[model samples]
Target: MPQDDPWDAEASQHVARNPGRPKAGFYGAVPEDDEDGRHPSSDEDEEEEFEEIEVVPVRPKLSVAIGGFAALLAVAVALGAQTTGPDARLSYAIVLFGVQLLGLLAWTMALHPPAAGATAAIVALTALAADYLAVTGEPARFLPLIWVALGGFVAAMIGQFIRAEDRQRARDSWRSTLLIVLGAVAYAILLVLVRQPLGAQTILVCCTGAGLALLVARLTDAVFPKPRIAAQVPRGATGVVLGAMLGTLACAMLGSYLVLPFTPAKGAVLGLVAAVAANLIDLAVNFGEAGRRLAGEAPTFWLARHMQGPLGGLALTAAAAYALTHLYLS
Candidate 1:
């Protein structure tokens, strides 16, 4: 057949008239396997491999350690309060120190960061110092279980104090304070209804006094929170050494309960003096440290450090007072 005129042919004319489309691959079309083999799917495998993560519960060892420590602390305080004979007192103090160290160690391991961990270390050291000093006094056989219970009570009170202060929660409020006082008084009256121990009256008085003091202190803080001082005692070298020496002297004066023949009044005065001296010494260490310009790890510190000398002194004084009262009056 005669070829149509090239430009006049119908299909040729249509192609010339229409605009041309770009090639598929030129427009970013995904290229298929030219060889006809299927590619392996990395995405499919990834989807299949994905999982929902599950979390395992971690039991809190900190709480347990804290509880145990608190039990030991309360026991120590109560035992310290109850025991007086040189031998009995010394033995209890030793045990109290040991338990306190254990508690401090447990707390260090359980909750506090390394920086603050030194608090526990200081407490442990103080306990050791107390124990060492306690050795100068005679040893007696007393109830271990009592000491343990008292220690636990003291620990609980201390822990409670710490918690309350940290959260600024009041363990005792105006209402609670009133309640505690009234409850104590009520309990004292109840003591009459149900005959109790020989010295229940005095015991009641001390318990009530302690409770009231604690409540008052806490409530006062809650009402007017004051800035806290450095945990460690501040002092100059001379001051700290002086304080430590005073601490030592207080220990010796307290140890005198074993040797001294005096009234509780005399012991009380001596104990009071020892306590004051020891506290002055302890405070001086902190004051002295503050005066210096050096910086490093916080000195091992505890409230007990401030307290021990005074406590020991007071105990000795009380013993003396009791002895004198009994001897002269009897």
Candidate 2:
């Protein structure tokens, strides 16, 4: 004997009553309405369901705890660097990198997930150990690492303010791009200017080079927009790198001709490193964003977003600047 279809009875009943409507089961069927012309369940049910969902509040206490730990670590590194002799340039570089890393971590944790704050703290300590193993020297000779540390915190706060304003204003794409470029230029200038007692000529050369690089990058972005086929690569990455290379080369040649203390070869080297670092930073940011969006609320997601993206970029840029000032200067 063959089994009967279970939907047959209901289908026949509805089909006979509503001849114009299609048969109902899974698809192409409208819900049956009563004499009042309303479904059995109304929108009120959905509203109540939505109302029951709870919103999690952000906990500032966690951010504060993590930031405090980072501050202590930074103080320890700074004190260690100060106690070291003047010849330990490598030690100074490591300390500078640590301070920069801590400052960036603090900023990211304060803004992003509170739990990821611990991850940022751990990374800072790990970096310190890695740097110690990688390079050994007496201490920084030219620039003060302490200023770079302080500058990190200041930059973070300023960045947070700008970011909030941008979101509130709903800035368009072009305006957003312009703001980011300008911010980068401002940061570069700040880094250079923070080195007190710098000669007028030194300041002029450094600022000009940094500013020109940024301008060239911005112009290049306008002229040669990323191609559709280049979707695999982050937008503006190629243009920014190319512009930084060209601008840095131009500045290096000019600096050499102007009889700047650093050799032309050193200038070219610094420009090349800066270009590479900029590209890497862009890639890291793109990758981090994509990872976060795909992974949702996972701890790994927050870790990548907070630690690997912005903080990584800032560290590379700081390292490049330190090398340029300390290694090249007479």
lDDT: which candidate is best? Answer: 2
- Tens digit of lDDT per residue, candidate 2, span 70-148? 2343234324433444355455545556445544443344225222333344334434433443343233132333333
The CA lDDT of each predicted structure is 0.34, 0.43
Cα lDDT of model 2 overall?
0.43
Stretches of candidate 2 exceeding 4 Å from the true structure: 1-215, 227-238, 257-260, 297-315
What TM-score does model 1 achieve against the real structure?
A: 0.24
lDDT of 1 by residue, 1-330 (tens): 787556667877788888565444577654343344533454566767884433222123422332233233333443444553434545555554554444344333322222233334434444444344334423311122224333433433344355434324334422322221121112112112112222222222222222222222223333332333342321123322333344334334433443334334443343334334333432443344443323443533453332322232222222233332344323
| Candidate 1 accuracy as lDDT | 0.34
Candidate 1 Cα deviation (angstroms), residue 316 = 12
* Model 2: number of backbone collisions: 6
Error of 1 at 5 (Å): 99
* Worst ten in a row by lDDT for model 2: 177-186
